[model samples]
Structures are given as C-alpha cells and as structure tokens.
Target: MKLISSCWIVDPSTFEDHVALLSSARALKFEQHCPLEVIILSGFNELQLDYVEELKALNVNLNDCTDITRELFLEYRHLMQDINDYEFLCFIRWIVISRFLVNEDYVHIDADLHMQINSSDFLKLFKGLTGTFGSPCLVAEHGGDWFQAYCHYFTMLINDKSGLLQLLGDTEISLIRTNIVSDQDLINSLEKNNRLPTLLSSFNLENWSVFINPLWPYITKPSSPVGFSQNGPIDLIGGKPVLFWHLQNDFVSFLGRYYLLVDLLGSLGDEDLVVKIPKLPIPYLQMDCSLANIIFRTLDGLYRHSRSGSSRDRHKTYDPLSRLSVTQRFIHSHKGREVFSERLWWENSVFLPLNDLT
Candidate 1:
C-alpha cells in the first residue's frame, strides 16, 4: 500500500506541513518497518532545500504538484473567492490524488498528521472493509436531523479511487460552487443524501483511553498508554496499537511546544529539570520554572477556548497562546462534537500531572 500526504506550500511559515510529511515518512520507514511507498505531493520549488533533502534522505518520493495546483486555482478561482490557498488545497488534493494514483490502494493522510504505529499491522485491522474508508468527522446530532455522517479526510483509506472521484466529480463541484462550503461540509452533504460510496470509520479511536488520567473539561478516562517505550514512541487504542495522529488544526501549536521543550531542556542542562510519570518510560520537564508554567497555562487556555461554545464561537475566541497541546486539547475540544483523537502532545509535551493544574 502507498502512504500519501499532500501539502501546497504557498507560505514559507507553514513549518508544520514539513514536519508532518517528514515525521510520518520517518515513522513509516524506520519505526513501522512497513513495506509501503511513501509519496509526498507539494510545491518542491517553494520548499527549503534542507527540508527537501531530509525527505529525500528518508527515501520519500516527492512529487511536485505546482503545475496541477496552478491549473486548479485558475479554473476554480472565481468560485473559491472566499477560500484561502490552504482551504483551496483541501478540495484540489482529491483531484490530484485521483488523477495520480488511479486504481491504486493508498492511504491519504492529511499533511498535519503525526504517525507512530506500524502501517502493515494497523492496516491489517481493516482487511475485510470494502470501498473507501475515512475517519468519522461529525456525528448525526451535531450535523442536524437530516445529516447522516461526515468522514474526515485526515486519514482516508482509498481502496476505490474511481468511486471517490465520482463523489467529487462535476456535479459535486457544481454543488460546492453554489453553496460555497468546505470540502468536509460538501462531504457531509453527500453523506446526508446517501451519495457517498465510502464507509465512515472511527479510525482515530477518540473515546479509547490513553494512559494519562483524563484532564478537566474532559470527564472520561479511556485506557490507551502513550510514552516512549524502549522500542520508541508508543500509543495504543482498545489495547491495540494503531497508526498516525491527525493533529488537525492544533498541529502548529503542538510543533511549537515541541521545539520550545527541546530548547528548554537544552538550556536547563536536562539533569534535575526532568521528571518521569509513573508507568511511562520517558522523562518529562519539571513543572517549576517560568517556561513550564507557560506551557501548562497555555494548555489550560486551549481547553477553555475549545469548550466555550460552537465551532464559530471557538474560532472567534481562539487564543493564540492557547494552542500548545494536541492529545488532551483535541479530545476535550471535540467533547460534545466530533470524536477525533490525536497523541502529538504525548509525543512532545512536558508531562505535567493533570491533577496539579487548576
């Protein structure tokens, strides 16, 4: 199977895209040992040479999608007047995928995803599944009475690219042009009308437990352990290990915390500043310094903002300082909404005791 990630680098500041593509490729090649082709679609000319070299070092097949992206923007620019380049790429990616990998079995993970588990072992669980499979985005209640379900494109297993293209063809594009909806919104509409051929799968395992005790705003503790085992970074769901974390909108913040933690550890000399959580293999930063306080406070702010109100409300109240963690934040933010789990925080956090935070 081929593992694909698509990113259109219109801005050089979008470092999370590079991190996502590189880290996932590394995970697939080094950690999972999965015999799958890793393909990346991005504007190669726009990417940094060092970043491109790192991907090449990992044996990633980089496909330059600049020409295709330009053509797509030219044709759809008028219809996509309100949409930005990033959002526009979301719709264009499917067209690119359909044309590029026809009749091929592939998993198209969003560029913001961070993968940990073995691909072969994870894909084995979906052996009997037919047609295309996507992670469950929004449930019936949140989407209204007429809504069936919406599948997130974050982690999609495309066994039938042709069938998927049918859903994204001229008719659907025309509908999108009329309504001016997001790719996910259009997908939800198709799902509501029973037009999608794909199955909505909860691949994220959002309700499943993580080893850490559930932090507030979030009530339940599902039992998945996440930490650096002697083998490497380990994350589990339903007592079974799985593949990838879709950090979604929290990726930039998560990456920021990671780099900040790295810098803090370096500055603190890593001797007495690190502490270990019980039953977890990795050491965490001690919550004593000003920097540590900043981390936790930012985390708390994220929880508050996410739990505040509706999607639009959350967007309006989005705290730039509050976007630091992914695992706990992702779980809590979607508490009453969609279920999308991610462990990027566990991979990068300073491991604060949840009970200690107010």
Candidate 2:
C-alpha cells in the first residue's frame, strides 16, 4: 500500500512557494508514519525532460499523466478566461484519482496548504469512511446555510476507489456559461433530483460529544445537562498529533489557523506548532499578477465579518499536548431534540493550533 499526493498545475501559474510548501507538507506526511511518495498528475507535454529532472534531483518526486493534452488544455484555458475556479477544481480533483488506481487509504491535500503536524497523521482524520457512506453531516459553518461550503476542506479521506466516477465520466467539451458554481458543484440540482450519490455520512463525523480541547485540555461537554443525559456520544480524549494547517484564499479559511496545535508528532514534543493566521501569499504571481487585489480581498472580508458581528464567531478548537500516556475517545450517548438559535456563530477566528488538521 502507498500514500500518494497527486496534484496538477496549470501551465502558466508561477511556481512561487507552492511547490516548496507542498513539499514540506509531503515531508511532514512522511514523518508521521510510513514514508510516502508525491505523484505529480500533470499535463503530459513534450520536451522539458531536463527541467523535470531538475525538480527530481532536488528530492521532489514526479509522475507524469497526459490528462492535460492539447485537447483538454484548450478547455482549461477557456475556463480560466471565464474565471471558473470551482469547476476547474472539481474537474482536476476527480481526474487525478481516476487516472491513478488509489485503492489504499490515501489522503488528498490541496496544493496551497502548509502542514503543521505530520501529514500522514491526517490519514486518521478520515480513516474509515468509505466515501460512499451516504449523506455526510455538515456543520453549518457560517451559522446557517447562507454561504456554506459546497465541499469540505481540502484534506479529505476518500475511501472509494471509484469516488465520483459515474458523474464525471462524461464531461462535455462545451463552454461553462451562466454560473460556474452550478456547472462545478452540481449539488443544487443533485439535491433537487434526489439523485445525489451515496456520499459520506455527516452524522458519523459529528459524533464527538465533548471536544477535549487539546489547547484547553478540559472536556467541554454538552452546554446543557439535558442534552448530555438525552443523547450524544462517548469518545475518549486520547493524545493525537494536530493534523494539517490550511491557508485558504489568503486569510486562514479554517478557524484552527488562529491557534497552533502544538502536539503534531505524538510524543515527539511540540516542535511544529504554528499559531497566527498566514498573512497572504508572499507574492501571488511573479509577473504582475494582482497580488494587491488578493490581499485587499482578505482584509476586506475580515473587516466586514467583524463589523457585521458575523465574522468573529468560530467553532470550538484545541491545542495538542506534548505527551500522552492514555488514549481517549468521545461518547455522545444521548438523544436530544434539535434547537434553533436566534444568533448564529458568526466568527471564523478559531483557537486552533497551527498544526491541528482542518
């Protein structure tokens, strides 16, 4: 069995620190558990063998796939012109897995993330889900579903080898007009038709009753006694390494970015904890790409979220302890009625260790 990191880069995107950052993530992945390999699922182009070798020589692994041939490149170019990032992500993600027969439990990390904990430990985050585990329960991140995530964070545990093969097999060769979200996410209609595939179950993931804040270490059980007595879960608070550090769209998209999950490598000590949100891409594009716009956008969002009293709320987070002598699991052993709150969790600055997994 092998753990593989598969990624594709558009032809024109500059290689600022993207390669270096992902390489660090790969290194962390190896440090946590079994030694892993990086599978570069790139467009098979002619020539540039020497350049490819140069990258290999520096210890960055490579594998070639012709998924991005002349035929597909044109479609990608058209998407870029129309500014369809969502659809592009979907097409690229499914394609790589399809080309590679990833039978073993492999974790997929988006290229932009920098690892704080051993990347391999991330495998534990989504270990058992068979990908086809029915409807996954989702946390209403922005309080409600006003602006929710179409997909979960980048580091996903994909158990099924045929994850989304049926839906994506027949991609059309036409321009994606009107809305990019509709063309890419494909969820609005899937939900309407009642034909969405057997996606991962959401209830299982949210089974932890008490969040043993590694940072706080205290088990913050259900807010109310009735909830605890009624129904929840029973899980232990064992010591585990923080999973991964994600940097989304400049500002720390995940609340965990605010605090560092110090316990990344189990008992190895808190050596790789990174607190504080990553400022911005050092430089978005080398050749006059709009770096200023990206930075401004993040700042603008943070400011808006703060002013509206909706940006500052965040989910409960934890810090990793340096060592652990016992294993812990949570048990939400109660059945309670769902209640609607007048105010929603509007903040995003969660107190997560820089190392904790997203």
Candidate 3:
C-alpha cells in the first residue's frame, strides 16, 4: 500500500511531541517493510536546524511552509489581520495536504498524538473501511445543545483530498472569536450535505482518568473495548488495545494536568493496553449529580447569550465553561489576552517575515 503521512509543525516548543510521533512511526512494523514517506508541513519560526536535521535523519521530508503560509494569509489579510498566527496555520492544513499528496492515500495526524500500535495498520484498516474519509476516533454524541457530534479530525485518513477540499469551501480563513473555527464544524457541514463518510473503528480511550489519579496506570486494566456510546466519555473499555492516545491540546505552555500519565506510559513497555479509570475528573463527575454544576451551567448559558448577543442565536458557540481547566480558563481570560499580546509581539518581531507583509 503506497502511503504518505503528513502533519503540521507550527511551534518549535512541540518539538518533543513531533519527535515522539516520528519515533512511534519508526517503531511500526509495516513502516520497516513498506515504503512510507513522512512529510512535515512546517509553519512559523523556521524550526530549529537541529530538529529539522533530526527529522531528515529519520528520512522524513520537510516542506517549509513559512513563506507559502504567509502568502496565503496575505490573500485573506484584508479580513484576517485581527486573527492570531495559529488560526492562519489552521487554514493551511488541508491546503498543504491537497498540494503535496499525489495519487495515493494519506493520513493526517496531529502533532500532539502518540501512537501505541503500528500506524500503517491504522492506514490499512481505514483504507479498507466504508468511506472516502476515515477517522480512528469517532466521538459520537458530545456536549449539550450544540456540537453534539464530535468528529475527531486529529487523526484522519482520506483516499484523496478532493472530498475534504470540496467540503471546506472558500471560508477557510475565518475565526470563531479568538480561535479558528474547528474541523468539527467542517465535518458537521459535510454531514449536513450527506458527504460525511463512515468512520473507521478504533478504541476511543481518552486520558481523562489520568487527571484523577496520576500514579495509577490504567493501561493495564480490563475494560470492555466495544459498546462505546457516541455521546459521553469512554471511561471503561475492558482489556481492549488502544490504537493511539489523542494527547489533544496545544502543548506549548499547558500540557493537561494529567500529562504526567503520558510520561508514565513508557514504564508499561510497548504493549496494547487499556488503562482502567481510577477516578474521573472532579468536574466531569459533577456534571451528572452536582447542583453546583447545574447552576454554574445555567449561569454560563446566560453569560454566553449575554455576551454573544444576536450572534449567539445565529451560530451556536460550542464552548462550555465546565470543560475548561485552570490553564485553559486563564488563556480564555483578560489576562490571557495581555499575555497573548506580548507573545504576539514577540512572534511578529521574531518569527513572522515582516518584509512579506503588504
């Protein structure tokens, strides 16, 4: 099976995560036997020469998208000046995929993911599945009200790029508040048009349990692998092998509080294991039974409507306060804006190619 795997590398700080991704790919049995090309679509700050050199050493291809990304952003600069660098980078993912991938199947993995099994098997599995596009993790029902369908785009396999490009359309550079409008909405739009394809099967194990007990190694426990609901968390899957851990968010400044568990994964050796839940996070536990959470959610709904005004009714925003961590909440606060401003100043001065700006 001819395959090309691609991922975006925008931040220098995520160099370790990128390294882990490469290392896991090398560990794949199929990678050793078959011809697989790894392409890193680099974004800003011109990744440290050492990191680029290391990836090249592993036979990984680097396509420095710094200038191209800037040029593309320029096309939308009239309406995009206020958005952050990451938002600009988000728009470049599908563009890079479409441009580089020739006549072959491709898998798009996020930089933060850690592979447990051979990724080639993942590609082979999905390629044979019923659908033009496939995602290993299909979060069926998610959140209350809006955003009920959580289609995880972090790990996606597509037979070709045309289906995805046709769905995304030209509204590529837009933003929802301070963040890029997520791929979930794009997938939802595809579903609305009846273009969304069947999702590939994989263990939907999240490390939410790791947050409750840092020392507990849930990977070794017995949990039912099948019978996962589309909505709600996958707290129990007895003894099922996990395909990959979606170490989901940005790891630049804040690794989730449970990130220590990811570090502990090395201790269990390389084996397909489903870690049992010691205890779920306090906030997640409260959502079902706590009066406080209910009241807080009620207040949060009011706050959303109050702040969103008419736009609240126009497009339902999916952000829920109950899901935010201390660091996430901080980044969403007024102080976060000041911090981001300083960071943006630094980025604009150092990383951004100002000469290219019009």
Candidate 4:
C-alpha cells in the first residue's frame, strides 16, 4: 500500500515535527508484516532540504519525497494557479493520489502525525472497503450540533478514482485544483450531490479505533493519566491501545494537551524511536484566565473573517442550488454527473452510477 503526505515550510517547529513524524512512520514500518510505500510532496525551502538530508543521514528513506520546484509547479500550473500556498499543498496531495490510482488505492496522511502501532489491520480494512473514500470518522460541527462545518479528518483512505473524477466536475475540479475551496468544502459538496460513500454491511468505519486525537478534551483530561497504562505495554486512549496520534495546530495551542503525551513517547527506550517536542520559532509567553480566553476568541474571529463569503455560505447551505454565486451554480453543472440512488447498493458496491440519479 502507498502512503502519501505533503509539507510546506510553516516554521522551524513544523519541520522538527515532520522529522518526528517520519521517525515514527519508520518505526511503525518495522512492525508491519504487509508491504508499504511512503512518499512525501515537499515544498522548496533550504531548511526543508537540510531536514531531508538529516533524515537521510539517519537512514530514513528520502528517495520518494518529491520537491515542488518552480518548474514542476509550472507543469501542474493549473493546480497551482489562483491558489494560496495552503491550497497549493492540498492540490499536490490530490495529484499524488490521482497519479498513483493505478496502484488500487492509497492513504493520505497529514504531516503532523505519528504512528504508535502497526497499521496492518487499518490498511486491510481500507483496502477491503467498497467506497470512494474511507475516513477515520465523520465529525459534525461542534461535536454533532451542526452540519454547517461537517468534516472528516483529511487523513483518509480513498478508492474508486472514476467516482471521484465524476463527483468533482471540471469546474469543481478547477476550484479544488486552484485551491479555491478547502477539502472540507469539497466533502460538503459531495454530501450535497448525494455522492458520499456509505459503509458496507456490519463494517462500521467508526468502529475501527485505529487512531486517537489526544488534543480533543474528551480523551485527555488535564488531571488524568497522560497517555500511558500501568498494566499494558502500549499507550491507552479512549479505552483502546492508540495506533496513531495527530498533533495539529501551533505548538502553543497544543501545549497543555500534547506535552505529556509527547514526553511519554519521547522517553521510550528504543534507539529507533525519536519523538521530540516541536519548538516554535516565534517567541510566545504563557498566559492564564481572561487574557488567554480573549486572545483565543479574537484569533478564532479573525480566522473566520479571513474566509471568503462564498465559502462561509457553502458551509451553511444544505441545498446545492441555494444561495449559490453565478460561478458556483455553473460549476455545479457538469457534463456527466454521477449519482447513487440506493443507500444499501451504494454501500456494498464500488461502481456507483456514473450519471446523477438523485
């Protein structure tokens, strides 16, 4: 199976975090009985170059990491055109999957993650599934209160390239290609078009507890055991042995929640294991009470405010045709639209109707 990830230089800490991420993936590969291939799409940064060299020096594979040079970016200029760096990175990830779809299927992982266990079961489950994609779990907004921002983790198992191509029309593809909309918005559009994959019988995707998000408050309490169990060799999370953990956002934002876990994992006696606390390049001061709350809220507001009005509307609208801008309306109209009618049929089969049936 092929595993892909993308990275751009955000900061020194991010690079360090990626190094640790690769280290963990290397460790997990040693435990795996199945064949696995890892590839990385990387941006051009001197530090990134140095980091790649360092990883190579440590015997980590650097052969598959593709550098996004200006010439290469120009070749895939359609994907890079009109998008910010974030969108550019996202589009590259899609390209990685699209170009390699002949290999049957692959998993796309975010850079800020570490594997804690052999993921053979998880990989087999994804390979056996009949769907356009398999996500860890679907999470509604605010933990199921709203559908406006419904999303699954970007770390996904994708299959059925034809279905994906049909669902993302040329215009929609352009938007995605150009990074006009986020991947979450792309999933929302899928839901709108009734193109989302359904789970196979008795094979609930949510039942697979392979990965854990310790950053979420429900799993890691400030006062509880940090991520270890006295009775077991593996770390316990949500009453199960954790296989992987995602450490997203800035180091400061995740300071309290992830520090303990990072410390525990970093302390493992294995010479092959090398988990490190990601250091932020910028100076930051710790704060408490009202000051922290205000800063966080203000940051949230600014983030929301930065998003396009159309994107905001897209998230809030359930009907595909409602409140759509002229461009959006045109994009939603495609030459050969694919759709599925029966939930059971869609769930059990991979060859969904290539024409819109809804």
Candidate 5:
C-alpha cells in the first residue's frame, strides 16, 4: 500500500516513563490505523534500561539520540551531531526517505500530545488534502513566530514541498555543529542565523503557508480553512478541534488567560457554561508522579470540567472509565467548557475528541 502522510518524532527520556508510555501508546495507535511511519530520536538511556524493548514491541523504531549534544564541558566535539539533531524535522520535504514508508502527506505529533483523534480520521483528512503526507505547506495560527510554527508546520502540508523548501531556505550545515556542547549553544546559533522563529511576535500570523496541517500540535481547536484567523475556533471545511494545547511548564504564565476566558464564557452563560478543563496530569517529562501529583487542581484544567455561572443546569461530559462513581458524574457535567490544551499532551494520541467532546 502507498504510505500515508503521518509521522511522529519523540525524544524519550528514561526518567519520564509516563511520557514514554504515552509515546508508546501513540505509536501503537497511529501505526495500526494511519499507514504512516513514526520516528523516535531519543536517548540511549531509555534503551539501556529495557523500557525501549517494551517500546519496540509497540512498533517503534528507535534511533539513538541525545537531549544535549555534548556531555562534558570540554571542547564541543559532537557539535555536528547536536546540530543534526536540532534540525531533525527539516527533512519533511522528502517523503521517500522514511523507514516507516509512505507516498503521501503526513503530520509529526509530539509525544507530549494526548489526542483522542482516531488516527483513521486524520488519515481521511490527509486523503482529502491529496498530497504525500510528508509534503510541506504554509499555515497561519495564533502563536509566537514562524520558526515555532515551522517546527510543527513542517509536519503539516500546504502546496509543494519543494516550494516550501525554497521559501524556508535550505538547512545550513555549518549551522549544525555535531560537537556542540550545550542546548544553549545550538539554540543561540540557530537564533542568530535566523533559522529559529522570529521573536518579534509569537502571535505573528503568517500567510505564506509554511508546512501545512498540524497547526497546533497539541491543541484540538480549529483554525479557519480559508486563511488567517480574525476570530477563534471558526470551523471551516474540516472541523473545529475538540483538543487544546496541554503545555506543562508554561502553566504559570497561562493561568490568567484561562481565567479571563472563564469570565467571558461565564458572562455569556446560557447554554454555554464556560467550560473548565480538569486538573492536568503531571508532565512526566518535567516531573515524576513521585513529586508530580497524578492530578493537579491548578488552572491546567485538563480533565476538569468547565463550569459556567450562567448555566443553571450542569452540562454532561465524560471522564476516563477509570474514575469512581461520583467522579464519573462530575466528569459528565462539564460539557461545552473549553479545556487548556497545553497540559495534556500525551493523552492526545489515545483520548482525542473525547466521546464528551464529540
């Protein structure tokens, strides 16, 4: 069968088993349905520890990789290796090169995302796009700058991959020194070379169409099909996303934004009680469950219900089948509420478009 346009890249750290478990779950789910290839460029630590064998059983092909290129502070000997790793996804243009095998357009989902999407549904979306999955396109969204978008966009599609190559410019070799000592050095070099996203505005919406699709990797909310958004969640030809970003560390900065949204949604309370996301699962990448609570009552609002002051009657929603009875009822009550997307990254693969979100 011809390959589909979907692939994933994940850096699995050993300490972050939850993240690994999530990534493995994703690889398992996607490999079965999407007919797409998934690539994992993670460290050897996970492999040396035997967790990778479990991961391998999930149909993942592990490429030995490092979080930081060089270990010691001495001279940067692995700078080239480091640069190669940094520019890892730059190869979206060539679909034939993947070991996962494919002849169509694709998306690279981060391991952190916890989507409830059926991989088959996404495959259908690509079938409509009519390009090889790995093909590139330019997409516009409400985020920092093109570079950041470019990273995710690289997995999505627009027009011609070659066109994208020309527009984004070729990857610079000197730019990637394998012997690089620190992540900072690699980041600084790229930022200086203008290879990274421009900091002028994280909100700078572009029209040029970098890599298409995967607009927001973790977020399920939709961007209009026509062009740049003048509004929010305005569904177009495809459908509005039920998903949202589930970022971990950034929570400290995002709390007030959600509060503002809550107040706005509550003010409009009628049928739409402002949705409340449940407490987000701790990001295993940054924190272990030992220190990280399985559930945080903070503003992350992942599994949390969105409560609108306007709606006198509580709305129905869904929680994992794992919850207790009272918790189950509580989970069912928060429908139509918006959840923060940044917190529940890993769940995207297994729990996309929760039956409730649908």
Candidate 6:
C-alpha cells in the first residue's frame, strides 16, 4: 500500500511543518516499513535547507506540484479569501492526491500523524473492511460528538481517483461571510448526497483517538500498566490496543512529546532517571507563554520533585512507564512546533533509535 501526505509551508521561520512531516515519515518508514510520498507545494523551498536534506535522507518521495496547486488556489481564491490558509490547504491536498492516484490504491494521512502498526497489518485491516463495505473511499468516522457521524479526512484510503476528482469538481463553495466551511464538511455533503462511494467506518475510530481542544487525560488502566513490550508501547484499555492518537494543536503536541519522552525513559527501568528540563529556545519560550505551557511546566517540576521521593503531595508520583494507554497505534500531533520544539527530545543524547522503541 502507498502512503501519501502533503506539506505547504506558510511560515518560513518555524520548523513545525518540517518536524511533523519528518516524524510521520520516520515512524511509518522505520516502524511500519511503509514509504511515504509527500505532495508538497512550491513553498517547500522556503523551509531551512537542513530540513529538506533530512526529508531526502528518509527517502521520502517529494512530488512538487507547484503549478497545479497554484492554479487551483487561484480558481478558488475569491471564494476562499476569508478562510485560513491552513484550512484551505486541506482541500488542496485532496486535489493533489487525485492527481497522484492511478491503478494502485493509496492511504493519505496528515503529515503530523505518527504510526505504530506495520504496513502489512494496516493493509490486512483495510482489505477486511473493503470486502464488507465495497466502497472506493474509506475514511475514519470522527470520534467526537460534534461530528461523530461525519468522516474525518486525517486518515483516508482512496481506491478511485476519478471519483474523487469528479466529487471535488462538482462541489459548490458559497461566499464565506463569517464561519468557514471545511473540506471535511464538503466531503460529508458528498457522502450524504450519494455522489461519493465513501464509507464512514467506526473501525478506525475504535482504534484511533483524537486529543484536541480541552486536552483530556489519556485513559489509563492501573491493572495493565503501560510499558515497552516487544511490540512497542504496551498500553491496553479494555483489552483493546490503541491504534492511533491525534494530538491536535500546539500545547497538546508539546504534552504528547513529553509523554513520549517519559515512556522511552521509563522503558529503561532506571529508578534514578534524572530528566533535567532542557532550557527552552528563546523563540519558542517567548511565543508560547500561554497558561497551558506554564501549567505544564509547573506540573513537570512537581512530577520531577516527586520522582526524588521528596514531595509530600498525596498523589502518586507520575510514573512514565505505568500511565500511558497504549491502545492507539497512530499518535498524531496536530499543529506541532509551537510550544515544545522537538529539538529537546529528538536531538537529545538519550533519544533511543526508533527500531529500539518499536
């Protein structure tokens, strides 16, 4: 199965886009043995040279569709002026996917998504589902109450490119005066009208969990402690392994990375593990001085103190190895790079190889 993602760099200074794409590619290629092809706009050149080199090192195929994306953007410019560029990119990506798809089917995932399961397992799951659903497009049903019945575009498997192209072409866009109509909404409309042979399956939702606004704590099972098994982070909830975690937003991504670091450190079984808080880069520290980061840092300090067995707080010391719910296989961090730059853990000396962790 072919895996695809897209990147359009709006900001040149921040490395969040690079980190998201790189992390997703690394996790899939190294852990799942799946190669990822990135359909990037021409704006990719705006990123740092080192990041471009890193993408190359991963052997991530870069398909530059600058002219096509630009032309499409121009066509929809009048109707999309009020919409955020990032949101509009979501729509643009599907157009790129349509162009890329041919005889073979493709799985299109957001750049920020991190994979835990291997390609073979994922393919097996898809085949089983398609046998029953018989749909050209299979998308995960949203887990939240707001759009529970709608299909989420974060992860999609497309078997028919022409069908998708026709659907997009026939979609209508009204002038936006206030709220923006997301591509997800459009896709849902198509599905509702029976114009698209799309299957909104809960099979993916049962395994994938999205952590977005009002970042909720991960559901933990004290009886089945989370730790590294030969299969990777063993977090079982209700006897079911988590297949994916969608970490939406900056602060959430920051926390997600912290949790990941703790899991890795805890796997070592080092009771004396002294995780010194790294000094934050000036830009990141200054830009992300939100209450969430402050609270996180404060709690981090308290947790560190507890690890030394000095805190008098009634709550048990945060045990990295024991807390995570490992049911989700795909851990996605949306809008990564704002608060906690990956440079802290990813570049650290203690960072273990992906092969070792998975």
Q: What lDDT does each candidate get?
A: 0.43, 0.32, 0.37, 0.37, 0.33, 0.45
Model 4 misplacement above 4 A: 8-14, 17-19, 22-36, 43-60, 63-72, 75-82, 119-121, 130-180, 191-193, 198-207, 210-231, 250-252, 257-289, 292-358
Measured by lDDT, the strongest candidate is 6
Model 2: lDDT to the true structure: 0.32
lDDT per residue as tens, model 6, 1-358: 5666667766765444333565555545432256566778657667677877777677676677777788877866555665677667765666655555543455555555444566456554554232112111223222221122222322231234345445445444333321224665555445545544443342454564322221221332123222222233433323345444443443344454455445445665744333343423332352377875676656656555656564565334543222121112234222212222223432223223223332
- Could you give candidate 5's per-residue lDDT for residues 252-296 as a string of tens digits? 223323343344445557334333433344333334444433333
Q: What is the lDDT of residue 54 in candidate 2?
A: 50
TM-score-based ranking: 6, 1, 4, 3, 2, 5
After the best TM-score superposition of candidate 2, give how far the Cα of residue 177 lies from its true spot, in angstroms. 13
lDDT of 3 by residue, 258-351 (tens): 2222223334463321232122233224446577457545655655465454753634432323122322332222121111111222222211
Worst 10 residues of 4 by lDDT: 335-344
- At residue 308, give the lDDT of candidate 1: 60
Residues 198-226, candidate 4: write the lDDT tens digits: 23332343443342333232222334222
lDDT for model 4, please.
0.37
Misplaced by over 4 Å in model 2 are 11-13, 18-23, 31-60, 67-86, 102-105, 114-116, 132-184, 187-242, 252-358
Provide the TM-score for each candidate, comma-separated. Answer: 0.50, 0.39, 0.45, 0.46, 0.33, 0.51
Q: Which wins on TM-score, candidate 1 or candidate 2?
A: 1
After superposition of all CA atoms, the RMSD between model 2 and the true structure is: 15.9
Higher-scoring candidate on TM-score, 1 or 4: 1
Q: Which stretches of candidate 3 lie over 4 Å from their true place?
A: 1-14, 17-45, 77-83, 128-180, 200-236, 250-358
Worst 10 residues of 6 by lDDT: 128-137
